[model samples]
Target: MSVQPTSAPTWHRLSPRMLAIHPIIELGRALPALVGVFFAGHAGGHGLLTSLAVAVAVVAVSITRWFTTRLRITDEQVQLRHGLLRRRTVATRRDRIRTVDVTAHLLHRVLGLSRVVVGTGTSDRKNESRIVLDGLTAVGAESLRRELLHRTPVAMTNQGSEPADELARLERSWIALAPFTLSGVVTGLLVWGFAWRVEGESGVDLLHSGPLRAVGHGLDAAPTALAVVVVGAAILVFVTVTSVIGYVLAFWNFRLVRHDGGAVQVTRGLLTTRATTIERRRLVGIELSRPLLLRAVGGARTLSIATGLRVGRGAEKGGEVLLPPAPVDRARAAAARVLNGATALTVDLVSHGLRARRRRYVRALSGGAVLVTAAGVGWQTGGSLWPVPVAVVLLATSVPLAADRAAALGHAHVDGALVTRSGSLIRRRVVLADHAVIGWTLHASLFQRRAGLSTLTATTAAGRQGYRVLDVETPVAIALADAVTPELLSQFRRRPAPAPRATMR
Candidate 1:
């Protein structure tokens, strides 16, 4: 149904694709509860009674979510109303809008559905971001985006190229690595391993009754240990495998088409799928990744962090990986194609100063220690003395490994792209907007003062700005920011036009 052209507030209907997403969401959320009910019924011999209750509840909840959810855009504002019982109605003026985004999960792929989300930066309320819109087909999302962008009044004249996705290859490889059955087993173990002590005692009692009564049976039994540990490991393996499988699901029928409107549309997915439309100028940064494992196969993942995403449910999770597990050349080509040389990039690891030398190894060592120690403790508490220490040692080994993975950052403007490398072991290549920077700052700490090192901070309208330091002369830091400062100032420059009155959307 079309949105009624009206001045008065009216409840509008969201796309059916939005409703269709409820079933998948419900299934994902209710899987644990479902398994519990099944085992509970068999163990407690309740037959169909308890099981039926769970089924009915699940169906009821899913149906309610699918049917009752609604969103509306009027002359003045956009409003999202959802929930059956404690209903939530979020309203915002059209003027507060900053960005809009669309994404499609692998599941959404099979159904030809894409999620469309809108983002705004104002915290007129609490720490909440602007409302997010979920579940729209590719075309509707495109139309909506164009309309919103046209009405939003950004610097349409200065718009550059559309943003690109980072980690697209890594995300794809992760999917290809998915072992669904194995992953499920791991999930079962993590969720049910704790339940086994209560398993023989009865699964039904735990669900209907909140208190869990621990039963001490044979702790040394191979089956019990195998059920939890071996099965859990297998589950992890499966998850990894499924991550690989995700590539197929997510990129199935993949196509990246350029529309005449200076935008890009990426359509891919297997079951209940999705498509996304990206306008050129909305991109803020491009992220590139070459994971340690993927490095062996020469894989590179790329994505973009655009004004597209906000922090909230639906589509506001910013920055989606554009190229999942593609060949390095292909991934780079795809990124370059989408960015058209204007994609934003971030510099995570610093190289121009002692910042890398001082904190890199220390942070890596501590991080490795904490991770390893936690794993070791978990293993030790499991009453297994062998795996606990083993886990700790393995984790401990990662400190130097991480350091090795990192690279030093030295940024230089190369053909409109700021390219730099940093991180100890995980070598990161930061490709960012060199000239689009909105602000810059230089600071020196007490230690930095002694070392004659000063940090250079570059600000953008994205989530945050980039911070880098140079250990060279104090003049160098200021010089480093000299090129950036003017750009930032120019972005904020005010025109001599007459002051205009602001009106509600």
Candidate 2:
């Protein structure tokens, strides 16, 4: 028996289940407003019936929205027509599509459906630039994802050449490094803020509640030193547990595959699964970022510096991340694979000189001294000597930090690639192709000129646009730019004077 090929879809409607789910999603979003309405009703501005009527109106609008929306997919474009009173149509050419992401939250997963987002990557406006088909069947969503991505003729041609190469997969052992990468302090603050918000809304004081009150009483009864230790241990445990859970949820079953068409696909997540595809051709460079704590454990994360991957306000986490927290060596290896065997990804960087090091220390110490002096003067007026010891400690700590930052600053060129490494607390190493560079900019501040140092910026059309090589000698910065793209800066190069005639002698 032979199987028949599936016919292409002309125009389609979202899964019928969307009729029920869309209203529920909208209602959940409006729940806070509904709550406010209920409170207002209880306060006698409106009655219970009024609140009920308002909610029903919201539900009616959502249901109407579901019925009015239609999706159409064709060889040339994916189009969406949505709206009730004012109909709006959005059409995006198939060729211009850069990312086709499939996301399924808990509700959609339970319903065996997902949301498909087809993006052009040129517009920052989410609704204007993308077509979202919500509540698509799991199978249908996957098919759409594949179809939309492989629509281009170039991609279709490449599809027959070879199978995708598996690049990286989640290793449970890497979870051990989670705590180092996690911002425990930030997490604690967020938790505290959330608790405070909840308490305010519910009219209950969390800190004064039963369990917390009992714990407070117990601490009050215990020795001060013991109480302090207990509190510290509890905070530590909370941070560690939160970090571990967050890491697991964000990276569960994480996998990276290099498709035959030279696109890197990333699929991961626990409760809300997300799959992102980044075309290798759009990739301008790779950045290996290591936070101070992660660096101590020899761990780093890799991000693709590419165009078209900047999704939603450009702050979307994991949008361009190729590797989660892993050993630096592993991250470098993965970067190399993504770059198609580009050795520049792992090449050693050239360090700045002693002058830069001294400058770093002097700047750090001077800043600290100014701050300390301000604090001391304030304390003197306030009749206190408390700022003296604090100043001493701060100035002392700045010395080693400055040294480390200076040591971390370096730049080099390898195999027609420009590499820059910098930062103290968060070490960033970027490897950019020389051909990607479009222009060069040289900057020297007043102090920098005196120090014979200048900063060179290599501007490109993709990635961060400008990658800087900082604190290099003026001549070195110019030489580096000339080496990368001789023609770009050649117009600004100084010419040598002609030799004097022999007859003058």
How badly does each model clash, as a count of residue pairs? 70, 0
Error of 2 at 476 (Å): 2.0
lDDT of 2 by residue, 1-505 (tens): 0011123655566777777777788877766566556665676767577668888988898888768887776667777898888999988887777777788888899888898777665422434677787877876666566666654333344244436789999899988888887656667887786666556544556777889999988999999999999999998888788878877877888998988767788888899898887666667788888989999999998887765555333222536778889998999999998887888866777878988888899899998899789878888788567777788789999999998899888998887789998888888899988888989889999998999998899997555678888899988988899888988778877789899877853
C-alpha lDDT of all candidate models, in order: 0.56, 0.78
lDDT top scorer? 2
* Candidate 1, superposed: residue stretches over 4 Å from native: 3-8, 15-28, 34-47, 66-68, 84-87, 92-115, 122-142, 149-240, 310-319, 342-406, 414-420, 434-450, 463-475, 487-505
What is the lDDT, from 0 to 100, of the residue 385 in candidate 1?
64
Candidate closest to the true structure, highest TM-score: 2
State each model's C-alpha RMSD to the native: 10.7, 5.0
TM-scores across all candidates? 0.63, 0.84
**Residue pairs in steric clash, candidate 2?**
none
136-211, model 1: which lDDT tens digit per residue?
A: 5555555566566555322332244334443122233345323321333444555675565445434545643443
Cα lDDT of candidate 2 equals 0.78
